[model samples]
Target: MFAKSTNEKPESIKRVEKVTGRLVIFYEVDICNKSELHKIFKLHKIDCVIHLAAFKYVGESVKTPLAYYVNNISTSLVLLEVMQECRVKKLIFSSSSNVYGNPKFLPVTEDHCTGQNCTNPYGRSKYFVEEILKDVCTSDPDWRVILLRYFAPSGAHRSGLIGEDPLSEHLNLIPCIAQVAAGQRTKIKIFGQDYNTRDGTCIRDYTHVTDIADGHVKALKKISEDLFKGWTAYNLAAGKGYTVLEIIKIFEKVAKRNIKYELFDRRTVGRSWQDDDLKTVKTTKVVGKRYIVLHAGNKNGFIPGADLVFSSSTKNSDYHGEMNQAAKLQNVQTLLEAHFGKEWAQHDNLEWYKNILKGLKDSENENSQDQEYEEEECNSLEDEIAIHI
Candidate 1:
């Protein structure tokens, strides 16, 4: 099998090779470099391409939009140009549900309008690529493409060898919760708690990363078919939404650990209080009480804090984070199940999350052992003095 690596470490690639039991011919070349990318096409006989190279962090995209645009959009263009030059027409593009922006209706389908109100550059980039693919297919009937719009992929591989390890800050909800549970972070910051939802928090559909991979495989198979032509999109999601609070509670139950979190007024750029301003408010001591006003793009500003300032409640609920029955109707899941089976599409999110916690614990243990060995190897005056004391 052929692969391209940019940010992936050698250890990660080795682990993947060990698990797959195949030698992955990986080129450590930036996809944006046309010459380097073209060399790979010439070196290997690549039948199909899975285009997953992109800058995907929403908040980071907002902070550095130019980087997002240049990398995400330009890379796709360069890759397409090279692919066309090499006569490689089949593609499975990794896409995001953020292309739909704030959903106008529940249970978003492939037919939902995209590129309308994308909140960040990341989403817009994906939309632009999808449009580009559509145009490419229109121009040439031989090209086949499948756009997989994934919603919040969580969990590691069953073997726990490879998982989501962000190079920078953990911006996503699952990783934030995991950090808090692992005591790496003091507490998670909930953006807002007054949204019009079941628990007054924004709800999102989440699917396991494994299931998303399976979806890609299914898409690849479908695109490779003789009858399959043109470009199509599918939503790879569990089809039901979960509130932020619900996810925390579920994690607490599964991990047997308290996850501390603080709520703040939801504000994203433009006319909103900055992080430094919020820190000042948090540390300030008032005579009787403290009042912090947050402008929510309206006349009457709202208080910055929630009614419940902090919570580590371990309250259990009947909610098991199950997939919505309606999700069975989704085109991707339907197609996957039809070809594989009902069990192929079905996944236990709670169980997957538990596995993630287990992996995190294992990593912690390994780190602890390494630290102990290093301590044993060192002998300092301070250590002797502390021992005598």
Candidate 2:
């Protein structure tokens, strides 16, 4: 219930606060702020922490590599240090399958080597944090760690009371398809249609957010019961892979609408820093209560956030040194609106621009670029989102 952005969907927080009363404390505080973060930790008798915070977003990470490293890695370190001070011993980390990169084997297992071929900066950041956790576990057998390396998560809650409210600019498959059905855009663009998989598109294991949450509770109980020490990794996915087209078809059938789409060879675009999972919520089912968990083709792999925070990450600082988040967002939307009709661009632009990186904010990386946009004619929202994939 702690967050920095007072503007990142205030209504959702309001709704939660309304029901929880004083049981759920909401703090609009930044974790990077040692003093503020510590103050909150002091208030609660926290024993175990779920470390799910980090900067994500593949293309943006590539554009701002250092931002990814500092936000994803440094912030986790800071949280850990605070946990140690507060005597929080057990931690469940929200890791990502991106650690496996372009998987060598189907249904990637926990043993798959990571950080070796991570092309995306976001993936590397997660891999590095996993390493840090391993070091922490090895250094102190008292520290119990469980790394949940989950695949792409989708679906919403069953109650439909609280659902995902992702910024309009970037969305996962379901939301994007939803947009198309609503006529937000013309078509869906499949990232790749010629992969080795049967459907030719990249195959990803998707699980419902509810299943993932239940799995964590199970993991916590398991860890407590066994007194397990050190590090253990588990894949929390519906041990099944679905092609982009397969998902589109399902949505189309359910919605009873023709989701216009176009298959593209690839895309070349630019985008920056997205943050974490300790306090992250996976993607919620689009609507209602009771998210029916997808039964995976592999029963063994079946597994499973509001925030759609693949990794519960936060940039320690704005890194870009831009205090005018409101102004910057106006610029991005003004720019996107020109290309993507008015409704085409609606996500809160400054959603990810919070906290300050301190020393790194002033320093510039060689790969970093100014707010620049390369324009190409795009008809569908899919083209806008998938072009950069």
Candidate 3:
């Protein structure tokens, strides 16, 4: 439910419907807008919501921590508040393997410690939402929620109608390698090669996008059942890990060309980290009574503060000035406690934010379009883009 953002390229809502043959209703509205979201709940009877929206880039989160928190966390809170008023309680939140942070073991589990090792604002924001959801389920028995934490989402559907189409060609490994193969880019910039693994490239659990979608469908169906309640999370992954060089070799064989790449120092690619070498890295900046999370990572994997704050991550001035936006972050939680002190804990704002994020876009976009289809009282479809290959 978005059509505005300097940094966001939200996939068209109509295009996904056309390819999948599913009845769809779309609204080009930002989730940050409270009234727009509430309008949706007033118009429909949404049973379940699969929230798959967020500002996902990890490096960008470091440069602009406040934007990430506001968009990913605060915006979610607003959505949850609206959903509760409408009494639509079932939710499926799109979480990430990045929330697992540096892997303490080979195969990461849902029970493995979270929020502790999160290295970036993007990951930290996800962790924060998960914690919020857990608290929500605790306070309310009616809430049924499932948090699906996934790794590298790759491959396409069997129909070949929809697939991964990144806004930036170099954003992810599969897309970046494809750009190099298709001659859209000069060479792939391999983040690092000094890891304690074979070929030294990063190792990750690459699952098909269809499987990830299927996982969500399964969770939705499960939660819809009477027996399901509270919060449960699972790792939607292949369990086996593939190194970057291994993936490139497969691409080389298929494309019949040597994909050239330049090696840089180890940097956190965010997800696709399950190896032993990766550890929690935090960059802290103290500003008066408030402390801003400047960067999150280890010596090898974290983005240098010099490159993050003063320099550009996207090479565009608008995207380059993320740090500038970060300076204006509102520490709502801290400030609320500072003035209201312990009285703040009794407020329902925490509960409101938790449940709202899970169904924010779905409730708001129910009748966003002029010619939206007839659903009696149902809001349909999430906005997504498709690829042809």
- Cα lDDT listed for each candidate: 0.68, 0.61, 0.65
Please state the error at residue 32 of candidate 3 in Å.
Answer: 1.3
Task: Compare candidates 1 and 2 on lDDT and give the better one.
Answer: 1
Q: How far off is residue 252 in model 3, in Å?
A: 1.2
Lowest summed lDDT across 10 adjacent residues in model 2 is found at 269-278
Residue-by-residue lDDT tens digits, candidate 3, 1-389: 33345433344444567677886666667876789888877777788878877888776787788989988997678777777778888888989888888766656888888887687888999999999989988989998889999888888667665665666422778877887898988888886675445576768888888889889889988898888879999889977777888889999999999899888755553344535444532222111232224332222343233122233345322331243232321233334345446643322222222223233332353332322232211122111110000
- Candidates 1 and 3, the one with greater TM-score: 1
How big is the positional error of residue 263 in model 2, measured in Å on the Cα after superposition?
2.5
| TM-score, per-candidate, Cα-based | 0.68, 0.65, 0.67
Model 3, backbone clash pairs (residues 3+ apart or across chains), number: 6
lDDT of 2 at 354: 20
Note the residue pairs that clash in candidate 1.
none
lDDT rank order = 1, 3, 2
Q: What residue runs in model 2 are displaced by over 4 Å at the alpha carbon?
A: 6-8, 14-22, 267-389
User: How well is each residue in 1-389 modelled by candidate 2, as lDDT tens digits?
Assistant: 56667235767766665544645566777778888889888898876778666654554676788988988888788888988778787889898888876554444568878877675788888998999999988888888888998777777767665556666354667778988998988888766554444455555677888888888888888678665768899888887667778888988999999999898753222110011111322221111122111111111221120011122123332223343234443444344445445544332221222211112232342222332221111112222221110
